[model samples]
Target: MSAASPLRVVCLVPSWTETLIEAGVNVVGRTRYCVHPADRVSTIPVVGGTKDVNWEKVAAQTPDMVVFDQEENTQAMADSCPYPWVATNVTSVQAMPAALEQLAKALNCDALLHMAERYRAALAAPVSRSGRQLPLLSDKHNSSLSVLNDDRPLLYLIWRKPYMTVGTDTFIHSLFTHLGLPLITPGERYPEVDENWLVQHKPVLLCASEPYPFAGKLNAVKDELQLDALLIDGEPLCWYGIRSLRFLESLQSS
Candidate 1:
């Protein structure tokens, strides 16, 4: 595939869909669930969602390629489609830019190089910051920072019921570790836990991300969670895009 080719790509993952737009790809169809920057996606073609998709409509469109995130979307949707497709699953912040580069190449959009490079730089810019040390937790468990019990512990709850925490071996943990922070949260991804554990650990900060918007109710949710911590935008730790540099820039002032 060459960058000059005018390819029609379908994005089934909400976040990756957003990434493709940021990378300047021609997205012909998107799952109804992939919403971000409302203005851009509002009027776009509405395909099916992660678990379900309008295969007939997708096939009828004759997309040159289909992009899938195994975590947010499934391969079954692309199977038997009229054109070729690719699927990816990115688990951490560092892998995000590389994955975006791969996606751009797959889409044959060399013009996307600038955007991909920016995100890649954002992923690496934290190395120079002068900090006392920051506390970290991830969607994984048994981390290298686990040995530093003195650091504050953060819990990334992907689900409410059974209340989960980030474990070791996750990308969120990897990013925090680079900043000289300790990741004490247990389990890979979100896992069930208790308020007692939260009260005991009491992280200095909590990050609320999309898939569930926590921006409006930060204080209320903080109180309800029984943790004395400030809730910050989860995108700085999660979302990968040109805006990520803005997040990194703000880190010094923060």
Candidate 2:
């Protein structure tokens, strides 16, 4: 009967939906890709993917709360929800945990506070435990490099269809910059690029993401271009919410 009790909840976006579930919230509805704790999410309702949601089915559930990314949800869906909605915008890695905290508070879940605290502590941990001084990518001089002006030109290729990528101002870029990675892509939204263009830039590191599921794709690309690169998990790198708490822990353990 109290607010602490599980509220029938729906998360219409993949990133935020996963965050809410990870924080121990009762998610009665979610997007297609909420794969963590697979069995639990399977019992919940499906409101389609991030960009496409089934409002009619969601309305049938009559949830007490609705969660989604501000960037991913449509205006019509926002207006149609009967309950109070908690919308989030995750553009970088740092902004994710806070969004998780917000979901916990909104759902009155005490477990979320622990997730938030743990995430903060993990993010604060030193990049190196060897007591040796390490350099951050952001501290480097901007004019020393070429391409997008020295700034450690790196690329965040997230999707393949349109060949999308993250810009220097985004959260992924912010994290890479913090780690002293360079930026190679321009400031526009995920620009489409061909093999020729990618090879021409001669990027030091080609960071591929998993969100749009680019793991195997990077390998083929590396072989074709004969470039050194690694396929990184896109959720941890891009989802800036309570899930970040778990992500940071993963990083520390690795």
Candidate 3:
């Protein structure tokens, strides 16, 4: 639908929900996790979480279209969708611009198209003098900072207990790759690990603030693993679309 004839859309992806809302789309329904632009999304009806969608509630809204993410929402959900649905897949930072463009075309939102071009230009811009990189591992007790080497492996932890980490094919990995960090984790997706595995691999540890609140237990993790770990914000690394574009812009300005 064109901007003049706005379609009633339901967005399941958190980042996409924010993007659509910012683009002035008539977002009729959103997943519970779509919390950005807090003032606006708070009024939108919550269908459910990303993985568990209430199709009944979704249908109640009579949305003309529903937006789904290839990774966040299950294939079954897409198959079950009664209304016309659009699926967005952003597995790498390099693919974000095209993904935004595709979504813009599907919704006929010129704002998203402009965002896509801006995002593309931001990606092409040179890294600032401060260095366009995520926070490095620093020890609180010691003044020495661990240097990141291209040859060495960096492991970014997302979950706890089993200590789940990301694989090379994930969006998180792509973010790190863009930051010039080498990830050594193996497997296709989130992989569970134990203390033994961490000891064996001896990778530089980075704990993320989301998917799990790694920041709260940062010291405990360092003490348990006997390794220097840094807490990193998960938004810029995982959240794509508008959030990612803003992050790239911030980096350029910095």
**Candidate number achieving the greatest lDDT relative to the actual structure:** 3
Query: What are the TM-scores, per candidate, against the unseen true structure?
Result: 0.75, 0.75, 0.89
Q: Give per-residue CA lDDT, model 2, range 201-237, as digits (tens).
A: 7664444546565544655655655554445556656
Order of models, best lDDT first: 3, 2, 1
lDDT of 3 at 229: 68
Worst-scoring 10-residue span by lDDT in model 1? 134-143
- TM for candidate 3 is 0.89
Worst lDDT run of 10 residues, candidate 3, spans 141-150
> In candidate 3, which residue pairs get closer than 3 Å at backbone N, Cα or C atoms, i.e. clash?
none
Per-residue lDDT of model 3, residues 75-115, tens digit only:
99999898888999888888988998888888888888888
Which regions in candidate 1 have their CA more than 4 angstroms from the true location?
1-5, 78-82, 126-151, 205-209, 215-225, 241-246, 249-254
Model 2 TM? 0.75
**Residue 112 local lDDT, model 2:** 68
lDDT of 1 by residue, 90-158 (tens): 776666667767777788876556566765665556454222233232322122443234455555554
